[model samples]
Target: MVDRPRKPSALATTPGLPPQPQVAFSADNSSVTATLPTGESVSVLLYGATVVSWKDKKGEEKLWLSEAARLDGSRPVRGGIPLVFPVFGTAPDHAQTKALPQHGFARSSRWEFLGKSTSESTPTPTTPAFAATATSAAGAVAAAAADMSVKLDFGLSSSGLSEDARAKWPYAFNAIYSVTLNTDSLTTNLVVTNDDDKSWECQVLMHTYLRVDDITTTTISGLQNATYTDKTTSPISSSTQSSPLLTISSETDRVYTPAGDSPASVPIVVSSDNKPKFTILRDNLSNVVVWNPWVEKAQGMADFEPKDGYKQMLCVEPGAVGTWQVLEPGDAFEGAQTIVLGGKTE
Candidate 1:
């Protein structure tokens, strides 16, 4: 027997690149986790394409998730960034969305994870010409590549909706949600496309729950002169934000809209003791919703655990809830918000 002829295996002939250290998927593919070279990471659940956790490079969690939040596909996740779409809250009496539930179906429907890609902050070409560069230059290029950020995409369409949801809002539509994890920031963008023949009206909101050491010590800025709809009242009264920084002391629920011709791209900052904690900047989102169940409301909700959980979290949501953004047939609307983590604390 000729034992001298062992063929080279495929693995031996072609070596495979190591697995990406920046992106990972759950065992059941129900979630994804993306990490940066700098040690920061973001985890997203496919249930609602909701961001479950976002941590700084030092492993400090920034997003708040309720302890009683349902993650078994039973109900929409209560915290983190649960998306609200097609309708803001309590479907208006309008004919289009009169029969829908509060906050629409985006957060309750299961989304398909569309995989991920990465973008280098400072792209370094690895072409043959660049490969021939000096060792020092090559080292610098490798260093820049290490700063690449990971972006995870999720998709949901009318065809993918449950029969109950599809029957309620019988319109052909598609939505894509992207979450990008950077070293010091997390950016989430949503693009909704109307595939129906007729136009439709809808609203979008990014319900972001930011974790804080103490709600009493936290204050939200950048809405001083903005007009807000106080949803805490029965009739939903309107008022102008008098103070430069607003502190939460009650069951707060308000939708802050741009005042007059104020730019819609202003940065909403959350701070404690005058030190910035999180800075939220939005694009194409003109309204911001600040919410907290406080003591009474918190104890009333079943999903809100610890009863006093409201004292450690604040919902600084960036949204377009003031008015409906009408989308024509075959058209698309995109809105995004970037949350930059503030300076690292001791």
Candidate 2:
């Protein structure tokens, strides 16, 4: 009898590409770890392709995880960098009134592991081509990337999604999420290709939660000359803040946008006692969300796990979340951010 062959699935192994010694699959075969030769490393879960953790050469965790975060694929894990796509906050318009559970569904969906690479090539995105716009910045990431970094790619397509999720989203598209880890930094790139026949509008964000020593004493800068929407206020106040640093105290939830009145690269710095300063930089992504559940809000959260867990975590998310974008059929959107530890800590 002749053996029949299996058609290619998204996660199928690429021919001639063997696993690298620096990369390892989890014991239970759940997650993958990519470690740099210099000892910096990152681990990503297939579910949501969420970056679960990043450790420096010293083996200190830079990203935060909830004391109560469920890692068994039950729900969106509460920490790390969650990929938020299709929409950012609540449905922004009438077409998406059906969007429930806030922040859209991309974070809860599973992604296909496209495998790891030192480098990979992809057709440049036509929609929201940010690299062209970032030319003015002399040292932008597009200039070049170091060859020593570890790269991993994950994919998700409407064809592989559940009918229930498709019925709501209904847009035919393919997304590739690339994660790069170097000795000093980690970069996450989301490239989405629109496979539909018509145009559609959507929002994307990298909701990154950074672990700090203390939320109360942490100082955040690079957003001083920016405009922010105070989501914690009853009326949702909008104003420009000129101060260089915004300190967190109470239940803080603020969305800040570069006040340049045009698209511009922004850098956000989060620093606290005994914690290495983190510098988050991104272009094309315009808005930054700063949040800490605080005491009362932390106690009320069902997923926070540790009732007082808010004290150790602060979220400083960077993405194109403040404005909606349109993607023409066959086009794509690319946005990336890099976080690096800099300077001495207390």
Q: What are the per-residue Cα lDDT tens digits for candidate 2 across 116-223?
A: 877422213352333553543322222222225688989999887777778888889999999999767889999989999998878889989898887878889778
Q: Which numbered prediction scores highest in lDDT against the true structure?
A: 1
List of clashing residue pairs for candidate 2? none
lDDT of each: 0.86, 0.79
Tell me the spans in candidate 1 whose CA falls farther than 4 Å from its real position.
1-21, 123-142, 260-262, 343-346
TM-score of 1: 0.88
RMSD of each: 5.2, 9.8
Best by TM-score: 1
Cα displacement (Å) at residue 173, model 1 = 0.8
Per-model TM-score, in order, reads 0.88, 0.82
